[model samples]
Target chain A: MMLKSKVSIVKGLSYQGGLPMLSWVLHRISGIGIILFVGMHVAASFFVHVVGTDSNIPDLLNVFYESWGFQLFIYFCAIFHALNGLRIIVLDLWPQALQYQREMTWLEWLIFIPIYGMGVFFILRNAFAGG
Target chain B: MSARSTLRPRSVQPAWSFEYIMWFFTRVSGLTMYLLALSGVVGAFILGARTQVDLQTLLRWMFFPNRFHVEPYLDDAAFWVTAWWQIMQILIVFFAVSHGFNGLRVVIEDYVGRSFWRPLLRSVVFLLWLAMLVIAVFVILQA
Candidate 1:
């Protein structure tokens, strides 16, 4: 039974926990996502600096980065990661706050949704407005 | 009882260890980036970025603060080319690159476990981090 359970866990088919587990998983995902974006962004800036702004590469990169789809994904990752990081930091500094983890997670979502929604709205507006 | 007294305290890793140092740095650098980005946003508005540049240009300026990013949009891009903005650009590049690459290292170490590839990958990441810093700083200085 133990071996079976371990295999299931390795396969990522286990129940694990719930919200807390999801939060931890999402945190890792978002962190990786942000790093990937940053790598591309920094490289683009460096390339533009070297080749000058007249090059088509900057325009191509800008088109990809400015798209509403990419913006939504990036903004979600960035906002979620930032807020969840603060939550983790609070828990680390004040261990007693562990008792309130569920509440904090809920609070995080409460805060994240509105900010992320606003960003999404603006991104869509810009894309539709042909800007 | 006071919150300090109620806090659980344990010492597993020494403060001088690489893991410990990086753990502390991750938090510090994350907070530092927030402050830097906040300043960037405030400074951008002060310089009339909202009216002068599009969303993309404003974002580019916010992230890098390089005059080249905003100069095409503004009639007077002189303010962005000043020493103060250059300093901000350098600081943002330094903190963002270091923090990001370190996070990648941590992720690799966590998932890769004990393997020959672990050290190899870590070295690769460190080299890339160094290269990125050099390129980013050079670009900022040149701009």
Candidate 2:
């Protein structure tokens, strides 16, 4: 005998899924972070254009933007999102690739680490050297 | 047995629907922005961004290509102020703003579920997208 139930299962965020789950969560977070940064950037540029760059807001924004901390975070979000996005697209185009998801993620990091490391180096140098 | 015969046909969505169109746009626009950004970076390096500009200025130029952004750091920014760069900036603004807002809409749809807030939030995102495009274009052209 089969019985029908009205309740629905909600299988939300659980850490047990490991890397795939972490990647999915980070993708969404990075996306939102990029959008927020873009909004502020566009607004700052618009304000500077309208106010002739002498305004305090753009100056303050530049100071905040120039910080190594913010720079590293934004760069990480951007590069990670882009690389992970490419991986997702590849998987979509070739469903068979899903079987190798773990390997693909490792490849993504293999590419991501050196690129992000170089960016970090330049940013730190610029911050310390006052360039 | 051939692979085509062995596998079941996949279900397809109607291409004319809003969701379907947006899903396609997301992929296309993401690739388009990459192309545009690549061009910007290469063009900046060619235009002396490597030696003349600092890392920060080079980054700003790579992302936006606005003449004013780089002019402060360069001896001659005439190449950046040209119509070609303006066109690139405009294209970037259009694609990036549209892609970003659509992503936001997807996020809203995912979380808000079946509710009045879904449509309302979508409308808000749409209006913001429109406003962003307008302001961005205005600034680009005015520069």
| For model 1 chain A, the run of ten residues with the poorest summed lDDT | A1-10
Q: How closely does chain A match the true chain A in each prediction, as TM-score?
A: 0.85, 0.84
Q: How displaced is residue A51 in candidate 2, in Å?
A: 3.6
Give the clashing pairs for model 2.
none
User: Model 1's DockQ?
Assistant: 0.40
Measured by DockQ, the strongest candidate is 1
Candidate 1 lDDT by residue in tens digits, B51-128: 888876887777668888888778999876788988998898888888888888987787777778888999999999
True-vs-predicted CA distance for residue B103, candidate 1, Å? 0.9
Q: Each model's TM-score? A: 0.86, 0.87
Weakest ten-residue segment in model 1 chain B by summed lDDT: B4-13
> iRMS values in order, in angstroms?
5.6, 7.1
* Each model's fraction of native contacts: 0.39, 0.31
- What TM-score quantifies how close candidate 2 is to the native fold? 0.87
- So what's the TM-score on candidate 1? 0.86
List ranges where model 1 is wrong by over 4 Å: A1-6, A9-11, A52-59, B1-14, B49-60
The TM-scores that each candidate's chain B achieves against the reference are: 0.85, 0.87
List-wise, what DockQ does each model earn?
0.40, 0.35
Q: Taking candidate 2, what TM-score does its chain B reach relative to the real chain B? A: 0.87
